[model samples]
Target chain A: MIVGDRKPMDEILEMLEPYENILILGCGTCVTVCLSGGEREAAILAGQLRIWGKKEGKNLNIMEHTIQRQCEKEWVDEMRGHVEKADVVLSLACGVGVQLVAEMYEEKAIYPGLNTTFMGYPVVHGTWLENCRGCGNCVLAHTGGVCPITRCAKSLLNGPCGGSQDGKCEISKDTECAWQVIYERLKKKDQLDWMNSYQPPRDWSTAGDGGPRKSVKIEEVID
Target chain B: MEADEATSTSEVPEEFRPRIVAYCCNYCAYAAADLAGSMRLSYPPDVKVIRLPCSGKVEISYLLKALEEGADGVMVAGCMEGDCHFMEGNFRAKRKVRHAKRLLEEIGFDSQRLEMFNLSSAMAGRFAEIILEMTERIKKLGPTPLRKGVKD
Candidate 1:
């Protein structure tokens, strides 16, 4: 899942200051899983704004709602009536959910409440970190099931560079050189010979070469 | 309480009472309180009950708003184990209570004041006991310092 955290509440208030009435939308899918932009969070944000606005005598009328999956058009349309009446929408969803809501309501000003971090898993309660870069390639079989490209600081294909003395990476005392992992893994598999065989340079065209990328299947469109 | 945001706590009389919005389920806690009253048992007059269909409908945001509006604390009382008027409403209420505790803790609250209690309607005395207990607890914790001293 893509991990994210809510933007500061101060920043959110600044963006929504112009609007007296606002509808805050929450997503029930990935954002809910990460516990960033969910129904509970949406309501909490709305309540906070109301209290603050009232304290400042700012006539801020706010309401909150959550959809099953704001990333889908079907789910986004469910709150059409609520969205139409509000002066603005504050989305408590991931980057994708924010975009989906914005695209659905072209005229409404949709603001994001989170900064999307990366593709990863929840390590434990309230802790999430990046684990995959989704380079559109899979070389886990060649290495020790760890992608050196993402984990390694140098992205060394076959390494244990001269700087690496112990098991840790040369760049930092904390990090384990991914090449060390690869060496140990290949050694365990009795396939150390594969290490000597130079791997061709990584194909840059397939990996982050252009600007932003997209993953889509025209055939799989909303079936 | 003082949702007006203008009435300063310092300006109020010590005897000035706090208003609490209690969401009590009809099955157990609400009836339990009524039984206490009918039986001439005394309890604090701070709470104003909002009879809810179930404790499950008590969102944490409501609790937060109660506190934000200057209620000393909010207590959610549900049915005793497996005795809900609506099956599993109290169970869902239990989950909401735990989640609310976590949220309040994250936002720098001790969360002891915001609480959930479970009891059967037969335990009217116990319901009265919990209200007294929670109310006393909040009184000791003092007014929510965040909402206090607003420089008028």
Candidate 2:
């Protein structure tokens, strides 16, 4: 899931200073799972904004709404009425959702309320760790399940660099060495021979190097 | 939502009294408040006690909504540390209170208006003292700046 963090109150307030009717749109997918931008968060932010407005003597009208997925057109289209009512929109979704909403609205001034952090999963109850870099390549077959591209500090194709100490990365003691984890995992599965197979340099072109990347769905009918 | 019927004590003027909401867990703080009442301990009437199953149930929104809806001060009272009936409920509440405080501060509101207290069910006198302390603190701070027309 794509994790996000709410932008500071100061930044949000500054962006909203000129607007009176504000719509706080929250996405219920990834942002909800990460507890950053969800229905509850949208409502909380609306409340905070209302309180701030009262204190600052601003006659602000704020509406809070959450859709199942802001990235999809159908879900965003359903909120057309609410969108049209507000003078400005504060999107609590990720960058993808925010862009999709902006594209759909075209004329409305859409602003992001969250800083889209990374494609990660919760390692613990409250801790999330990035596990995939979406390098446009699959190397899990050669290495273990761990992705060196995301977990490794250096993204070494073949690693356990000079900084791998006591199974921890050189960058931080809290970070587990991806290469160490890969080695240990493969060793446990009795597939250490795969380590001897050297991998060539990664191709960056497919990973949005030239421009934006897209995956078109090609439908096939049964003969 | 269980506020005292009396808005102010006999000495303080009604205008000077602050509207405080205290969320007390049934296992400890609520019991302590009850004991204080039975013992005839006279605390200020500014505080209104709302009972909860556990302090951990006090969500951040509740604290924010309290202030947003005209509460001058808010308090979350739970079991003493290491003595939570649900085991770690108070600890969770402590963290939530800290997070709420940060949120309040970030919104340019006074974080001092929100607080958390921990005491056993047997601490009747301590319950009265906590109320008095919160009441005095709020008195010094004055009414919440978030008050609708007053600030506007």
Candidate 3:
């Protein structure tokens, strides 16, 4: 899932200074799973803001609402009433959700409340680790299930670089060497020969660096 | 309830009396408070106790909302370490309190205004002492920065 973190309160307060009626919009999908921008998070932000407003003696009326998925137009439409009532919206969704809302509400001021971090999942109860680069390609079939593109500090294709030492990445002792894990997995499966297949330089076009990426379900689209 | 309005009708002196919200876990701290009451022990009246099933159940929103509603200080009192009736409820509350403290600091509020305490149901004297400690600390800190001048 897409992981995100809430922006600093000082930044949020500064952006909200000019607005009176503010709506804290939360996404119920990715951000929710990451424990950053869910309905509870929306209420938490609203509570903080209300305290700030009262302290500053500002007449700020804060409202909070969350939708199933902010990137979907149907879910975004459900917030039309709330969007119309607020002078500004602080969207606690990923960059995609923020843009979709901005595109739909051209006349309203839409702001991002979270910094979209990466495609990842919680590695522990409260810890999340990025494991995908969204390269628009799947290399897991060749390498073990480990993603060297994200886990490796250098994103090495044929890793266990000189920096890897004792199963730990050179960058941080806390980070396990991705190649080491991959080597072990492949060795266990007797597929160590796969590592000999040197992968060529990646084509950048498929990655986000080329441009905005999209997918169209030809059969599902009508018109 | 409006704490300020509720206090306005009291006969207490006009000095700055900080309003404090104390979240007491029913399994321990609440019972300790009851024991304190039965023993005729005296503590500051400024501290209002809100009983919860477990301190673990205290959400970060509850602590922030208390401050938002004009609480000068907030504290969560639960069972001592390894003594929680719900196994790890007090432990969870301790972590939540720490998290709430960080959030409070981020908002530019004094994190000292919030605290967590560990107690057993038999610690009646300690319960009163905790209230006095919090009340004195809040009094020294004066009203919450959020409640300094806003007329609710």
- Find the candidate with the highest TM-score and give its number: 3
lDDT of 2 by residue, B1-152 (tens): 00111222233445677788999999999999999999999898878999999999988888888988888789999999999999999999999899888887686777888999999999999999999999888876766666646542
Candidate 1, residues A1-223, lDDT tens digits: the string is 7677888766887889799889998888888888888888888877667656654556677989999987889989989999998999999888888998999999999999888887777767677756678887777778867678877887777776886768888788977777887889889998888778877887766677797777889899896
Superposed by TM-score, candidate 1 places the C-alpha of residue B77 at a distance from the truth, in angstroms, of 10
What TM-score does the predicted chain A of each candidate obtain versus native chain A?
0.83, 0.96, 0.97
- B1-152, model 3: which lDDT tens digit per residue? 13432343252345877788999999899999999999999988888899999999999999999998888899999999999989999999999999988887676667888999999999999999999999888776666656645574
* Residue-level lDDT tens digits of model 3 in A134-166: 888878987889898888889888888999899
lDDT at B59 for candidate 3?
Answer: 92
lDDT by candidate, in order shown: 0.77, 0.88, 0.89
Q: Cα deviation of A197 in candidate 3 (Å)?
A: 2.8
lDDT of 1: 0.77
- Of 1 and 2, which scores higher on DockQ? 2
Clashing pairs in 3: none
Among residues 3 or more apart in sequence or in different chains, the pairs in candidate 1 whose N, CA or C atoms overlap within 3 Å are none
Model 2 chain A poorest ten-residue lDDT run: A214-223
Deviation (Å) of A122 in candidate 1: 1.3
Which stretches in model 3 have alpha-carbon errors above 4 Å?
B1-13, B148-152
Instruction: Tell me how far the alpha carbon of residue B87 in candidate 1 is from the true structure, in angstroms, after superposition.
Output: 22
